[model samples]
Target: MTQIAQQHANMDETLMLEYGKGNDTAFAELYARHKGPMYRYICRQLGSKQHNKAQELFQEVWVRVIDNRNNYTVEAKFTTWLYRIAHNLLIDEHRKNQVRGEHLTLVSDEQDEGILAFHQGKQEGSVHNDFLQQAIKHCVELLMPQQREAFLLRHEAGFDPSQVCEIVGAKPETVKTRLRYAMSQLRDCLQRKVGATEVGGEREI
Candidate 1:
């Protein structure tokens, strides 16, 4: 690795600790690293109409991160900690507004195509890829908020079921069920486009 690049490759927990010790540079580096994906996640969750509110919540999350640095721990991944704060803030916003939006399932398209590739018997990568993209987009819109959030945490954020339960404050079975229901609904929604993916919808999640 290049000398400067190597220097920039600090582990998330290590950077968190460094920032906790009042190193402004460490905090800046950490912020720069996660800012994009974090902002995208917030925007996706809150949607376009609430962009201003999303920006406000984004700042609020960072403020909490900075203020609570002394109490940060390495027991979980830094991104998980960050997402938990965002998720809780979103929940708070929902409670305060007495609304949770329209329960849309729009997610960022920057995720690995794997999030769109759940076909069991159908091809993984083939000519229908373009068609499947639209199908996935339409299908995702069918998911409820909990289902969509669970799906994003697992697929986009790469959190496993247990970590998802922790970050989402849900039970083990509940998290798994949410994932199953999400995939099932998406699969069912686009079955014709998916072309015999062999996914089952009988399971309750």
Candidate 2:
């Protein structure tokens, strides 16, 4: 592993212990380490609409971590346990909201602006990338709820296929299938939005 990864691996246990001992800085470090992945996972789970809810849920997750710090064990990867907490929070939120639609809005105005800027910068000479990213987001939004959850758990959260299976309570092969289908749908959608010609010459992800 690179230096940063090695450092993280070394500090994971120490951070957890420190946080459990009421060390706020340790908790802050833990948040800094996992926030992006957790936020992305929540964003994917809620589609783009849960932006505000995600923030609320994120804080709740941290609060749970703090409240239950003394109960943590090092048997499993801290992230796996952390994600489990997030996953449960999402389920509760979904139930409370009675969300029945497949299109969960994952992006807020702020995130949309950042995504737009990211694509725009990449496609400096053309609008293809911007169009492609928007199209992909739309296509992703249309995914079946389970498929979206599985795919995001695998990609955004960087979970292994087996880990994704565990998180989503599916078989490993099922998670693989979901990711495959999600990617295929996104590729087709991007190709259509940007046109086949543009897609042929587009930069690889």
Q: Which candidate is the best by lDDT?
A: 1
Q: Candidate 1, residue 30: CA error in Å?
A: 1.7
Question: What digit string (tens of lDDT, one per residue) describes model 2 on residues 1-205?
Answer: 3787657765876798888888989988888988998887777677666678778888898889888899988876677778888888887877766665433544344664455445544553677655675767666766767777877777787777887777767788888888898888777756554553344345332
Alpha-carbon deviation at 130 in model 2, angstroms: 2.9
Name model 2 segments beyond 4 Å from true.
1-7, 99-124, 196-205
Which 10 consecutive residues of model 1 have the lowest summed lDDT?
A: 196-205
- lDDT string, candidate 1, 44-137, tens digits: 5665557898899999999999999999987877878999999999888767665745433454453323444543323434745665765665
lDDT of each: 0.73, 0.72
Error of 1 at 112 (Å): 24
lDDT of 1 at 195: 43
For candidate 2, the lDDT comes to: 0.72
Best by TM-score: 2
TM match of model 2 to true structure: 0.75
Q: TM-score of every model? A: 0.68, 0.75
